[model samples]
Target chain A: MDRSEIENLIARVALKDRAAFDQLYDRVSAKLFGVCLRVLNKRAAAEDAMQDTFVKIWKNADRYSANGLSPMTWLITIARNTSIDRLRARKKGHQDIDTPGFELIAPGLNPEQAVVAASEASRLSGCLDTLEEDRGKAIRGAYLDGETYADLADRFGVPLNTMRTWLRRGLIALRECMSQ
Target chain B: MTEQTDIPRDDDVLAAELVLGLASDKDVIDGRRRMSTDAAFAGQVVFWQERLTAMTDGIDPVKPPARVKKKLLAQVFPKTRVSVLQRVWLWQGVSMASLLFAGYLGVQLLEMNTRPGTQPTVLAAQLVSDTSGLQVLAVVEPVKHEIALRRISGEVIPNRVFELWAILPDQAPVSLGVLPDSETVRVLVPEALRSQAAQFTLAISDEPIGGSPTGAPTGAVLAAGSMTEL
Candidate 1:
């Protein structure tokens, strides 16, 4: 995706320009739907999630540029978070993950310099593959499955604090591998 | 900077944990608040977000079924809905047929007007619409500013009421009132519209039991015609 092009569309959408919103949806909906499907797994549920994701995009577009993340990150993160919110709602007593405060930032500040170039970001999958067997699964399960530490501890049959420590260490190693 | 030791800083772990949603509810809430106030901590969170979001780069884009876009756009930009009666009146253009029908009713009414002077006593119109059997003959008593109506055809749809309206040129349809269940009914014209009564096109719409909640004609127009001088 052309980052600036997506950014430009978002800026227009912030102004409530319907044409730009339509263009932006055409440009990114396929990718966002893919992300929703990955997290939700059911076709109908994923479709619903995708709808909600766009509603949020239309409503929150004004808040986008102030958020420090890149445009695609802002969008995909919304799809991921919306699907996960729906997923958690299905189960009884599951803790609701609040939509993350991605918009919390000083106005006029852009994080373009801090953003990992798309090329280097692609190394993330390879980095995950290089991790010791269980570590990769743990990270993916937590990130994609919306599993909490308690859920992970039960799945891996470890103590709760142990799961936390394990995930913390796994993240550190994963970060190191990605940077390489 | 990469962590040189086995352990890393609390903010790094917190940011990563927060991104993956591994943080507890309380911690996540606090994390959100901190991200708003603490720019450095916010950048740490964004770094993980950018990296982790790339995990989906492998997920192939599936062109969604077309209905999704259709549904989305309808919700986003809804056009004012045109009712079946309005479509007949506006698009199928039964308005000309209505005028012809009104002229026929007018001639008959004129022959019956034996007790008249120069002043017109009764103005008449035949409310007719195509494709629906609904037809009405409206006799406007010009002096009293009242209209007496009798249904010629079509049944009052169950649970729906017929509402009378006076439509003037280039203006919205104004509600006269809901027609009673009986075939013959009388409706008083608003004093504001008394002068325009000579040039008025009266219409009836099928509305909810109490009539259109909004003042305008919200339901399907059953029948309509321009008043003819008798």
Candidate 2:
């Protein structure tokens, strides 16, 4: 849905519009589910987080504002934070969720098909190209392997501070390169 | 040579650490606290959001169990007076509660205006943030001024006066002014802040019931807004 339409629905939801709230749920649940799965690393846990996030959104619908951020961003922020909270609660000494890296599924594809297939994959590949070797590896290791900074430090045989600096510097470089 | 600015130049670095989870427990705690009050850091969050959001794509989509949605539906459409999780997640934050309260009040005021024997000309509204997230701490929008504020630890807001500060990215916070009266304070925003709504904080401080003596925040913060912009 567009911004104005979403805002209007939010306004109605603030006024206790239940149908609008349902519509809002239909629009963003998939993306939110993806975030939950990433953090929780389990379908059941991710589902739990999604439910919690939307419930929080429903109760807090009145707090929406044009001054702060877009409605989608607001919903995503809620989902991300709620998932993080669940992850914190389930602290099994695991930080990152175990996930696989992207690969080019089909080599020769049409333009639209190619985009549909590699939208994020292409962005990651491009952004990865601009990163320094070690920083890129550090980010990949932590994010893909679900390794914490401390864990990464132990694996890399570096101090915690040094690992932090590497990850921090790596992210900055990636953000800069991608923003352009 | 030494730099003249007090802004943390390593903010991007800090943001990176945050995404990488390389940030220490202190960084996460401090970042969350600062996000409550600091507008610039809020913007930094948005920037990081756009960046790290792509990383989420690597995960394969999984269909969740039905019980989850059933429980969620139960929470959203609660049969009783708000659920437990709702109160904890929605109301715990200083800004979120205030904002929801203001919105409730705004809806009431709007409803009242729509009643018979009333002639409403302009609509007034206030936006508040959830304490759980980086958001506006408190907001009271009258006819003239839209009073919005975020939480800042150790920020001093005196009895009568309100201290206003402009937060900039990679720069020191600049003072806007002290709110002399509670009526409607229009803060003259810096040019840099015209495009930055999320990184600046408008703090109200207690003074001699008149204004600030030192031209900066002199008391604890009464209200503030998360610097996250639309």
Candidate maximizing lDDT: 1
What is candidate 2's TM-score for chain B alone?
0.31
Per-residue CA lDDT of model 1 for B1-230, tens digit only, reads 12243455489888888888787677777887888888778777777887888877788888777888777876765422212223333323344433433343445433434335633545677799996778777777655567878665577766788999999999999999999876578799999989888789999998999989989888888899997754
Where does candidate 1 stray beyond 4 Å?
Answer: A66-68, A93-101, A107-112, A115-120, B1-9, B79-230
lDDT of 2 by residue, A1-180 (tens): 487787777776665556777777666777788778876678877787798787777667766654334455556656766676566555665343111100011122334432332343336646876798877777776544346766788988997766666666666677666655
DockQ of 2: 0.12
Q: Write the per-residue lDDT of candidate 2 for residues B153-224, one digit (tens) a residue.
A: 222222344456654566655676654432223444555554454445544434556556666566655444
Report clash pairs, candidate 1: none
DockQ of each: 0.31, 0.12
Off by over 4 Å in 2: A1-4, A67-70, A92-125, A140-147, A155-157, B1-9, B19-21, B57-66, B80-230
Q: Cα deviation in Å at residue B131, candidate 2?
A: 40
Judge the docking of candidate 2 as incorrect, acceptable, medium or high: incorrect
